[model samples]
Structure formats: C-alpha cells, structure tokens
Target chain A: MTSTTAPVDASTTNRTVRLASRPTGEPSAENFRIADEPLPTPGDGEVLLRTIYLSLDPYMRGRMSDAESYAAPVPVDGVMEGGTVCEVVESRSEALEPGDIVLAYGGWQTYVVAPANQVRRLDPTRAPISTAVGVLGMPGFTAYAGLLEIGKPQAGETVVVAAASGPVGSAVGQIAMVKGARAVGIAGGPEKCAHVKDELGFDAVIDHRDPEFKAKLKEATPDGIDVYFENVGGKVFDAVLPRMNTYGRIPLCGLVSQYNLTRLPDGPNRVPSVMQRILTKSLTVRGFIQNEFVKAHYKQFQADMAQWIADGAVRYREDVVEGLDNAPEAFLGMLRGTNFGKLVIQVGADPTQSA
Target chain B: MTSTTAPVDASTTNRTVRLASRPTGEPSAENFRIADEPLPTPGDGEVLLRTIYLSLDPYMRGRMSDAESYAAPVPVDGVMEGGTVCEVVESRSEALEPGDIVLAYGGWQTYVVAPANQVRRLDPTRAPISTAVGVLGMPGFTAYAGLLEIGKPQAGETVVVAAASGPVGSAVGQIAMVKGARAVGIAGGPEKCAHVKDELGFDAVIDHRDPEFKAKLKEATPDGIDVYFENVGGKVFDAVLPRMNTYGRIPLCGLVSQYNLTRLPDGPNRVPSVMQRILTKSLTVRGFIQNEFVKAHYKQFQADMAQWIADGAVRYREDVVEGLDNAPEAFLGMLRGTNFGKLVIQVGADPTQSA
Candidate 1:
C-alpha cells in the first residue's frame, strides 16, 4: 500500500476497480478487482480529474462480455468504463482551469488524465453536478433521440415504456406527455409504479411483477399502444405485443432482462408468431444506439433537455452509493431491477466543499 | 354438379371455387370445392362482368387458415377472394360500357356483379389485359411502395431481395437498379437465379440452395448490403443478417417460409442475438403492408411502371394455368417454390380475340 504522507499530485497514487474476469451470468464480486497505482500526469492539451460521481447503467453489462457489440469490450486488468462527474485537479490546456467541475468518462477510478476537449464543463449554479452524469447526460439524450426520432409519438396516441422509474424510462414518459401523447409506464413493483404515475405524471402505471400484469396493461391502454419504447424485453414485451395498434412503432432501446443469460431460455421458438404480427399490423420495429443520432440531434437535445430540466417538464431521480468499493454489488443489484432510480457511486466528496 | 347449359344473358349461371376446409401444411385439392349457381340480374348502379384472368398470390394461403390475420378469413363456403381482370358484358351505371376491360376484385368465378365505381378501367390498347392481374396491379404496387417508401434505396448502395424471380421481388431489384443502386438477387435454384440476373438485369444473383450461398453473397457484395427487401425469411434471412451494414434498412413485406409452420422450431432461441445486432449495428427492420402508402404513391407508381414497361426498363413474366381446375394445384406448387414468375389462372379466353 502507498503511504498517505505522499503529496497529492499528478504523480501521487490512486485506486481503481479493474475487470478481473468476464461475467457469464449475473456478475459476481470475483469479476472485479481493486488495485492501487501511480496517478497519470496531464500531458499537453490534457487535464487530471478527481472522480465525484460515477454513473452505473444497464449498457455496462454489454461491455463485460467479449461478444461483438456497438462498442469494444473492456479488456481484463483495465478499469471498467463509465460516465462520471469530476473536478479538474490540474490542467495543461488553455480551455480548462484546475478545480473546474466537468462531465467526463473517467470510468471506475478515483482520478484520471484525459484530453481537455473530451470533457464538458458543467455549471454548478444551473443544476446539481451529479445530474450531468445521469439525467442531463447519456440517459436523457437516449430517451430524447429514441422517442422523437423513431417513436415519433403523435398527439393523442398512447406511448408505453418499461423500466418506467429509471432515468431513461422516466424521461421517455415525461417527454411523451410533453408531446401531447398518453404515457403508460410499466415497472417491477407497486412502489416504482406509483412513483411513475403519481410523481412522474404518467397517464397509467402497471406493476409488471403482478400476476395480473398483462391484464392491467391491457386495461390501462384501451386504445392500444402506438409507440413502445422497449427497454426491457421479456414478459413485459410478450404482453405488449398483442396490443400494438396498426402502424405501431417500437424503438428498441435495450433488453435488460436477457443480458446476463448463460444460454438462451428453453423455448418454443416465438420468432414466427412475432413475424406474423409484424406483417399483419404493418408495424415498424426499429433498434437504435443513441450515438448514431448524435450528429444530427445532439445539439438540439442538449438545449431542449436543459430547458426541460430547468422548467421541471422532465424530472429525474438518483440512488447514490458512497464508496467505489460498493459499485460491483450495486451494479449487480441494478441488473436485477433492485435499484429504485438511476444508480450512481459517489467516489468522493466535491473538492470545493471544505472537509 | 349443376347443368352446364344456361342462358348467356341476365339470368346466366356462374361457377366458383369455395374454401371447403382449413389447410394444415400445404393446401390440398380436397380443401377446395367448385360450385355452380344461378347468377341474378345486376342491381342499380352495378355492372356484370366476365372473368378473363384471376391472380393467385401467396397471401391466399393465410385466407385458407382459420387463424386471425390482417383481414378476415375466407368464409367456409364463400368464393375464394382474388383480384381479376374482366370484360363488362352489361352495365347499369355511367362508369362502364360493354366490352370495356377493367380491374376488379371479382374473386374465382366466371361472371359476377359489382358496383361500377368499385373497379378501375384498364385500356387493352396500352398493355395486355392480363397485365392488370400481375405487373401493373397489386403485386407491382407492393414492390414499389415497400422499396421506395420503407427501404429508401440510395444511389451507389447495394440492395438485396430474396425470392428474386417472384413478381414483387423482381420489381424491387429492377427499381433499385433504375435508381442507381446495385441489385443483388437471391432465388432458390440456378435457373431462377440466372433468370433474375440475365433477364431482369440484376447486378448480381445467387442461388440460396448452394452450400456456399453465404460465402457467395459476401463475395458478391464487397460493400455491405444497405437495403434488404425481406419477402422470404428463414435460412435466407439468417444468411443475410450478418452481412447488413451499419444503418441498413430492411422493408419486411413477407415471410413465406414460416407461414406454414405448425409449431415453433426447437430452440436455443436466436431472438436475443437478433436484437443485439439490431442495437449494435443500428439497423432498421420495418414490416409493412403496401396499401398504407397507396393513397400518396399509387398514381405515381402506375404512371412510372407503365413507362418502364413500354421502354423495357422493367420486364415481367407470368405462369398462366389453362383452366380453373388446375388453379388449386398451381397455387400449391407456387407456395412450395415450384412455380416460376407470377402465377395467374386463365379462367376464360377473351371473346374479342379472333381464333
């Protein structure tokens, strides 16, 4: 272990959680290892950051596998990648200054050095810095692009989203409401369902864990679903399939339920039935990654999202854990739908606050 | 059977094929029965017609099953529904005159009566009367709408269509080529594949039956496929899936291979794998019924297709059966991939043609 007496500078040491092994099912603590190493120095046009809040999302499960994916897999012995809100501790560029709070992709580390252009400076007075790692960042942008671009929710139509209390789903429901569409939310329990309906103002919210979940969903949207922003594909999707209206659009954003599966579930293959409905209904089922629309929609998204957040047209919730060591367990819980809101790890206190 | 001799006037008799039973796998001749009955006089604003050509399409297979579909199932003893080209023998409305050839949904019959406004008049001088039942009608419209509206072929891109020798598939390839996109066609055998490439002018063609079919597809498309007009889904779809480029668009018009499936195939469900690729590659798979775009694009389609036919920019072939007795067998053969080109039953010869 490094001595605490060492000066806290770019050459000083830091600790990080590394990918110890690839996960086959629900990841275990054994899949990650914590290691301490010397901090990297800021080169020209670079800055050193001290992590404040790290965002944990479902997409991370994809990064742990060696399978071919939109993005490259995290290598063994490397820090697990993620979005973070950090403070610049040292700057070698004219664009940034030390102690500035900014949004970064510094991953599961206490400190990181990255090119200055890669980080965006966050205004502490405008909104909480932690939000830049959640609602004002990737999750919010994902909901905006997937819904408006693909879902194309027209006025008076019903739009349904699953995992409804999470950052993405909650934002999707609120945005649909803003667009003058009916929003129906599906969550795992009564509490989350209540949060979606009473707090987030969804037109209807159903607990998917209930035995009568399918029936509830059917009754909730009597006019049938026009846009299903698919985030969880399992029983939730199976129920929604039959109720899709003609010309229905499904913007498939994620499939969290099947992510940790070691092998395909035993089945009577449902592909034919799915295809049959698609043909008869003239449905449009499109899958998308948020980054694909960034060049065209990102600037608009940032401006609109910031306004929506400021005006309370869009609301977000966060479940913050205090220490880096707890991320592995919190992430596992998140995959199992145990998290109540967006899960974030507060790696350390904001450096601007006096100890 | 009723007596064949009857007055060839307002009280003339009509003969029709009816659905006797639902089919199991391939429809058998026993599942259909022909009936002869007296035809009543035309009502006010209705016209009487003599059937010249009746179209036989794959969609008829769905009508033979009791299972629910986009449209209602054919009643147990009703005339098998179909599009036909007919000559007006009598008229009670200003829209028609005797000897006029028109497009009508007159079903499988020798003579029938319908409101004059329900049919579109066809000029025999502009093209063969039988073309109204094939290339210049529903099948051709299906191809035009599905490709241009949903597939959105761009110049210099590669467009792949399965069932390439079939009516819809052939048109899709031709139109893609006309729009400056490279067309790669997939058909069942060497003869059909040759016809697709040589006769239709597809840039490249491959036989799906070849053991090296997938490898051949990769070799033919050095640039990955940008548009996939999906009409035949099965092993053919499996082969084309991995070859799809980023942001590829698939306009799924049909899935002929899975229509007769009695039960789901044994699993290691491939659905998850399919969804994963959709997210990672950002591919768009949309299912459509062509009629959705008809109100906006139909007039343009008819004008453009007629010009293409006249200049040889588009060519069409038909497999016509001599009599209605062979219609059931021909249709069954078509569903099994044994018939080549558009399948039409020649119910009767044109009275205007001198023999």
Candidate 2:
C-alpha cells in the first residue's frame, strides 16, 4: 500500500453536508444542505484522508442546535461533525503513509485534512475497519468510560439501560454482565426488545412503549435497580427513579428521548420525587462525556473490548445506510429510534477489501 | 463534673410528649399531646438520664408521617424521637457515672433510660454542654460529613447552601470557607440572610423569597456554582440548577421545603430540565445521609469540628425555646423558616452551670 495513483487529487472535488439552519424541534431534511468545496490540502504534520464510513449518533442532534452544552454547536453553513473511518490519501508527516486506514473527525464530507497526531491508525487484520466508527469506536468508548467510572456496577447488582439495542446501551449491558451484574435492557417495541435479550444476552428486556411499561420494569427488577445507565430520558427516567435501590448509581450518557423536546411533560412537577429518591436511597446521578475519561481509561477500553470481541464474550451489529446523499435521512431516523444498532453511512468503497 | 451528689429519683413520675396522630401534612399541635408515664428504670446494662435539652430537626417531620422513608415513622401514642443533651441520673454501667453530661436519644421526655453504651459522655471542657446537641453534635457531623466527603468543595470553587442560618447550613457555609472555597448562603428573609453573611462570614447571601431570586443567584455566583449542599430543595434548587457550572457537584442532603407539601408544585414538570442540565453540564448529583459516612468519616469530624470551634473558626447560634411544652410549635415554625438557628427545647436547667 504505497502512493496510490497520485492520491486521486481531491483539490477540485469534494461533497459535504453543512448546517443550513438550527431545528426548532426534531431536525428535518430542510435543516441540512449538500454543498461542494475545493478539497483541503494537507499542511505540515497533517494528512488528507477520504472517508469510507461516517458514524451517525444521537449526540449529533445536540451539535445541530445552538444550546448551551459541554461542546460547542456546529455554526450555520458549517460542516456537520461526525466520526469517520478513512484512508490516508496524502501524507506530509513521518508518522503515516498513503493507503493507511485510520479514525478521523471528517464530519459529513467525503474528504478531510487533519493533524496526523490527532488520528489513530487502524489495523484491518485485527477487526473490521468500519468498526472504528461504531462498537469499537466513540460509542463503545462512551459506554465503557461512563459505566466503569461512574456506574461502578458490582456483582449481583441490577443494571438497567434504555435504548438497549443501540451501540452505547448494548455495550453497557454486556459489560455489566462481564462484571457479574444482572443486565436489564429497555427498548421500544417487541422486536428491538427481543434482539436485546436474545442476541445481546441481557438478563431481561422490557418494551418501553408497552402500556404496562412501569409494571413490567418493576417485575424485571425484583431487587430494585442498583445502576441505571441513562441514554434515554423522559418516561423511561420517570419509571426508573422509583425503582432505584439504596446507593444506586446513574451514569447518564445521553437523553436521546428529550433531544428534540420543545416542552416538558405536562403535570405536577416531579422534582420533589427526584430529590426525595436521591436522599432516601442515597443514589448517585452523574452526567459525563467520554472525553473526560479518555486519558485514564481509553487504553484499557481498547484492549478489553478487542479481547471481548475476539472471544465472543461481546457482539455488535451495524445498520449501514448507503451513500453520502442518504446521511441526513439516516441521522434523523437514528434519533427517532428507527435504527436497529450502531448507525453508520457507507460514504465510499472500502479499498482494503481488494488487498 | 463527677458524681458530686446522689441522683434525683424520677421513678414515680414523668412528663412526656407523645404522637397523638399522624398529620396529613405540616404537623400541627393537635397531632401531638401531653402525657404522663412512670419514669423508666435502668436495667442491668442501662443508665437513667434526665433530659436537659431536646434537639428538634427537620427529619422529625418525616418520622411523624406514615410515608415510607429511610427510617421508620413514629407510631401513634409513642414518644416523639429526638437527640437530647442529658445528664446521667443513675448509672448501671461503669463507663459513665451520675452527674456526667452526655448525648442520648432521649426523645421528648423528662426522664428516660438507654443502654449505657448507646450514650457518649460529653466533657464540659470541650465546649458548652448544650452544644453537644447543637453545633458539636448531629447537625455539625451532618455538615462536616456531607460537605467534605460528598460535595468535595475545592479551593476557589463557589459552594452554596440553603437554610443558611440553621445549624447544618451555617456549618456548611463556614466549613466551605475553611476549605478555601467561596461560600454563599440562601435563607428566607433579610434578617436571616444578614446573619448568614455578616455574622456567619459567608462571602455572599441571597434570600430565596426575593422576587428576583434567580437574578440574585446569578449575580452572586459569577463563576457559577461548583458545589451545592442541597438541604432545602424546591424553588432554591430550581433557581440554582441552570446556574451550575460544568462538572458541578450537588450533595442532596434534605428537602425541608417539600416535607410539609401535601402536593407538588403545579404543571409542566421541570424534570426534563434537570436531566438535560445534568447531561450537558456533566454534573454529579448525589443524595446522602450523615449516617452513611459515619463509619468512614465520624472520627475525623469530632476532631476537626472541636478544633474549629476552639480556634474560633466556627461559630453557632441557638434559638432555644424555653419549655418542652412548646416543642411542637417551635418545630412547626422551624419548618416554615420562622425559627432562626438551631432550635432546641431547654427541657431542664443546665446541670453543668450549677456545677
């Protein structure tokens, strides 16, 4: 894998998705636009890459809005940010060469140029290169860091997670099981619930959309919940709070259910119940981003996750939406809980398959 | 103060306050009634005590209701439970002698008997004997354990506490100051707020009842709140939540404002905001009771608190009600923020002052 036909010269050809306007609620196709720009050139200590797989996650909805958040939102007319598995097309740094596969923050573009030090080189022989954008990438790291650092699940403890079929929630349940805790997953509809329990090997699964959701959740957690890895907040959270055990820990990763919520649920406020449950049960509810723990936990996460995949102790599924033109629709579907698993866009043909 | 004279016998008579009925909400005088019982006799391993000071705290409100809580509710016709500064009237064990001041769970009674080992003898020279039930006692330990152990207020961080004129809140603000953090107190009125800032030496004070409470809180916390010692969670908590900085810590200890609420605050549940704020700001909201830290941090609390009071680094105020008969009314007032500081019923004359 040396210099491949002079790098295809992306300097005159680039397709990108830029934010047209912020959404009032759930994002629509009108909020994004397809644009073309002269491809950027690699500067000193940098590499130009062509994206092969673009990952779409629930958090991207947050980046599309100008809300006060842990990270800044994408400015109007700017490229929508995303994680990508890319092949180095042009290299100016000693650390890398053309044809190398690596992970990059390439946004929703077909090509990008970034500092060589910022991307991690990937080995295709060890695992699928596309996983660098899914289970084995940012989403996996999100579950790993949040559960271990904040959730601290112990043996025999009941750990419940909503959005259980998604990348983060699936890993959370499996990792909890590896730690000897009972894993209970909550997903929408029976199909997703069945997949979570039978395929993911969770101890139990409950359908959040069921009319008897609260009763089913109570039945699933006989000893009450000791850890709730919160990815979906709203009705799911309201039901889980009363069921938490004394000294329970809630590692809140994302509130996907409320991401597009324009208004809160109508009723008598539940703040008193939250405060009471916290005090009476001595529960810990901590919200965190994966980057905060990367320095301390990333190395361990990669090693453990790789071995888990190799040994069949852990498994993953990818919902690969085809073409760069379909990314906006796929991203919107992922937020509405339509994606079956880790959602990613097949941006370009994989050159590694020919090797 | 040793066994200088014979113990006064109360074997033939006793005066006590017993729960007449559980209140629907905000316990009234009718819910409590005066009663007489034959003074309890010390058994082989128990000691007889004469109640000198009865400490009334917000937790008693929880015990007076039938609602499930961390601890059991007071049964009808049972003497209301409380922490009391007492004198050993009769000793059956060698650990304590008559005339020694001690801290005991003596309830609302003139005379009672407890296991000798359950009561700890108090040295008058350590501080005032009354303080054994006030600043140097349970309330002090609550503040010390919750702030240092859970809140973990760092130097230059802004720490805020509500009910700032009370024993727990005052100690919380002062201890935060001692830890090199900026302290802000929130009380009910100008008088209590003034005492919290001017007398207790808090860096700033805000009255939660002010019409511009949210604005005032924002002004007081320029860097945003890093640690919130939550004791009176309701409107104060609502106003403070949005102002919290990223990675903020909330040690939820009590909710005095909601203790008397027959119903929750009206409409459009604010739970969504709580979840969203928690996720976006990467906050840590932990609920706890002082007893949880007793095994790990109790010994250190006694040493540090004594040294603090000795060096004039900590000071306390006592809103001493004159008689045991007035306890129910004073307790009710305290819940409404009418009582200023550590409310205690002076059940009997101080035995140490006579010495």
Each model's TM-score, in the order given? 0.95, 0.96
Query: How far in Å is the alpha carbon of A252 misplaced in model 1?
Result: 0.7
Highest DockQ: give the candidate number. 2
Scored by TM against the true chain B, the candidates give 0.95, 0.95
**In angstroms, how far off is A328's CA in candidate 1?**
1.5
DockQ (CA atoms), all models? 0.71, 0.79
Worst 10 residues of 1 chain B by lDDT: B1-10
Fraction of true contacts retained by every candidate, in order, equals: 0.65, 0.88
Clash number for every model? 0, 0
Task: For candidate 1, write residues B143-207 as lDDT tens digits.
Answer: 99999998899999999999999999999999998889999999999899989999999999999
Q: Kindly report which residue stretches of model 2 are placed more than 4 angstroms away from their true locations once superposed.
A: A1-12, B1-11
Q: Write the per-residue lDDT of candidate 1 for residues A1-355, one digit (tens) a residue.
A: 1113433443377778889999888888888887778888999999999999999999999999998888899998889999999999999999999889999999998999999999999888777888887788899889999999999999999999999999999999999999999999999888898899888999999988889888999999999999999998877888998999989999998999989888877776676777778888888888888888889998898789889878888989999998877888899999999999889999988765557
Candidate models: Cα lDDT each = 0.88, 0.90
* Runs off by more than 4 Å, candidate 1: A1-11, A351-355, B1-11, B351-355
Root-mean-square deviation of every model: 2.8, 4.7
